[model samples]
Target: MNAIHNTYWLLAAAAALILIGIGSSLLARRFGAPLLLVFLVVGMLAGIDGPGGIRFDDVAGAYRIGSFALAVILFDGGLRTRRESFRGVFAPTLLLATVGVVVTAALTGLAAQWLLGLGLVQALLLGSVVASTDAAAVFFLLRAGGLQLRSRVGATLEIESSANDPVAVLLTTLLAEFLAAPSGIEGSELLRELALQFGIGALGGALGGFAIAAALRTLPLSGGLAALFLGTAALFVFGATGSLHGSGFLAVYVAGVIVGNRNVPGFANLLSVFDAGTWLCQIVMFLVLGLLATPHTLGDALWPALGIAAFLMLVGRPLAVALCLVPFRYGKREIGFIAWVGLRGAVGIFLASIPMLMKLPNAELIFNVAFVVVLASLLVQGWTLGLAARLLDVALPHRDRAVRRVELDLPGSLEREMVGYAVAPGATILIGTALPGWARLVMVVRNGEIHMPDVAGSLSSGDYAYLLAPPGRVYRLDWLFAPPDEAIEAEREMFGEFSFDADVRLADVADFYALPIRAKDAPLTLAEHFARRYEHTIEVGDRVRLGPVSLIARELDDDGVRKVGLKLERLGNVLVRRPWLARLLPQRFVAR
Candidate 1:
């Protein structure tokens, strides 16, 4: 009965923590905040430092949990990554992963030594902790940003984060060993061991990938079973490689990619499973790390942590990005965005625990500092991501999924397939344009409303164009959905999806559309004009629709909208049971 009670409490505690995590994640999503931020904060709140007073100080247990979480995240990253994406920016991204890690480590190490007054190895260990761009954070940011990057830049950053994790791990392990003073290990042996870890990790991952893919293709398993098999195989590879002193990160990731890329029954469903599992893993890992830190110790190292974080952000990252990309060609803005976006997440904090586990001097202090750095990175870099991307003109309007997915559910039929594509701005094909003989345009979904295109119609930017095509010949649909061919793609200034040039002013916007703007609002800048209307903070991407005109907060900080984009609708297009009903509603209502 006592055992049963203890088990019941354990289950309840786990359930409560997980519920908070999920709720926090939903809140983050709604507010355009980083999900990891909520996870970390909720964790801190659940720890000894907060009211619940849960005391968790098991370093070994934390490390073990972290190891599995990292493996799962890596595997998911690898699975989702496209080979073509890698092929597109291989040279620069590869260089960035390897050379960039070295430069970032060295620069950050120097700063740590100077700022924290630590010894060489200890400083380097701190450096290694933060050396890699976190795959988990970067992946989430890209997905949650609700914007698609220009293909090259997005792919490069994604690949760089995944590719560099092992490098950072190796560096941290080596530095921790040296810091703990096992000086008798020869340089040659160290190199050989490092080589073995990479070699075996990659090989194990590839083998696991093939095995999973083969099983998926041959077996008539349900989606749940497939997910179960995939998870089991992934964990097996991670464990196998780790036992052999190999890079478990590399093995699981490689395995995931191999399985993910291949066409298998329930592959899409498998991906969804991976995504959920990865989220759970990230939440658990970060929460445990947060629980490990004592709030008072973190307070003592506060200033040094801030200084080191600043150095890493302002100096170390950009310098490393510039130096590493010297061999390849990337514009300054792309490099700048990349530099700013190198967020530290689960990996950095996990690496910080290594020194503590090894009983190195100042290990707890370093852990505290690492926690601080992760906090700063997520809070600053993560928050400003969408704004920075737009300001740099590196983001392409993400219209790729304009339509809600529709399935035929036809009995015993495999010939016909349904597909959805978002009509990008500047697309050449109009709505009424004829599709290929093999396919038929079925529906258009816009602004959360679906309209069946039973007759020919014109398509516009942000319109979800749904079509049906014979599965084998669906390739022809690409031509119609492709963006317009133009001499140079103009970066249209967006005020809510309406495109205008920089010279366009508030008065011009009102006058051109015959919309009323008060004399008080006339002189306000785009960002300032919107600021006058909101009673509360307006986050980036928040929208306020004024009957026919929409105002979107394009660039936002703590100070509300830093930039605004406007969209105007033809007054005639407004639909109402009684036209006066539209006129009676509030002119502006904000959407979360």
Candidate 2:
């Protein structure tokens, strides 16, 4: 009977947790506080002191669950990273993760010692634990909330947050062990341990990621299944490295970069799953931590906690960022922005639990300090991150004139066509051109004139215009207008070998492929007819052919079939090509 009751209770608890998670996620958007905070509050409500009255005082279980959840979350985060973003930011990010963490920890430790009268060990623990920024926190807040910034600035923060946590966790664990040992390890030994952790973690991560990428390229995994298998492999790497006394976090993060950069099959769908899983892990981890807290214990340490929190926020974080960024030539505003946005959440709380579990002297005090710090970070730094970005003048301006790709069929074409090109400023060819061929503008909407080009006409960044061109020559256009290196690659679509600056005219385009079929004054599908005359297979799934361009297939939806939308290019057939070295090496890899 007792066992039966236990089973029923467990089932009920699971059901309640599900309902709470769904409700909290929905409420999170309405409330300015992050969704994880809501989950924490909800978990607290379900605890002994709240309506649920469930006594969940299982610290060991909590720790086990938290560790597993965090490992998976970190691994997933790594697998979805873009390796190129790390190029310029790597040196600075590394310094921030290493020297910056040490400096911040030391500064905060001193402050804690002076302000709160904490012992040296306790102060160091507090500092080290809170030193690293929370990956889950920043990732969710900045990206999911649509917080935008300049490419470099956004890249720096994202990379730093993702890169630094493993080091902090290492510090926390090592420090905790040292403090508890009857004969504490020597400082030299501690340094050695730190070096080993980083060495193994970084090397393992790089090797693991490369191995996974190589395997995926050579392996025969299907798209959907490949995504799942890749995620699992990342987790395996993290666990395997950590179990060998190495930094698994580093391994996982590095692995993610490798996978993220490569053209893996079904990566988009996998990214979706990884992001969703990360949120779930964060909610559960934070909520469990919140529920485990006793209000009475927290209340006792409140004043000191507040003091420590204030010191970490106002003094420790800013100083660290400023010092680390100086060598990178970051401007004042960029430095200031990074400084202000060092929001802490679950990581600190989880670290505090380490001391509590070990029954360290003043464990409750540490927990209270951690809790206060977490609250302050969320309320102060997290909320102000966006405003700070704007104030610093580092926010990237949003431009709506960027090119958009759309597929249009001419009046009576049995086949399809692909078009791609960019509108250049002061384009001579557009000045004396005709309606379908001369207009050059693909976005002007009146009279089916997409857009008009002028001497001062602003070219939309990353635009791929859809026009009817020959199938074999579209690649020439893509080669022409590929953005200056480092621009985000736009999604690919089908057009006759879509590229930039080809001589395919708009009317010629419609006439060639039979586009603009919906309107009364539609042009002829000459491109489509050309495809039929050549005995080429120009089906729905096939690529469109301009004289030299080709567009690939993307989707078929309710509105219409969507292919790679490219525009007719106006330049004569001069294929702008690069040298072999330029093609082989990324911009960042070149020696100074």
Q: TM-score each candidate.
A: 0.73, 0.68
Clash tally, candidates in order? 8, 73
**Tens-digit lDDT track of model 1 for 1-592:** 9999999998899779879988888877877788888888888888998877899999999999999898888888888776667664888887898789988998899999988889887888899899899999999878867767766778888888988988899989887887667676679877987898889988988888888888888988888888878887899999998788888888887887777667667666787776788888988887888788776777656998999899999999999998876567677777888898899998999998898899989999888889899999999999889999888756754432222343432212345667787777666566455776767777888877888886425777888887887743443355456564430122122333343322235665565455677777777655566554432323444455555776665545455565555554454533322455434433232121
* Full-model lDDT, candidate 1: 0.76
Query: Which prediction has the highest TM-score against the true structure?
Result: 1
lDDT of 2 at 232: 77
**C-alpha displacement of 478 in model 2, angstroms?**
17
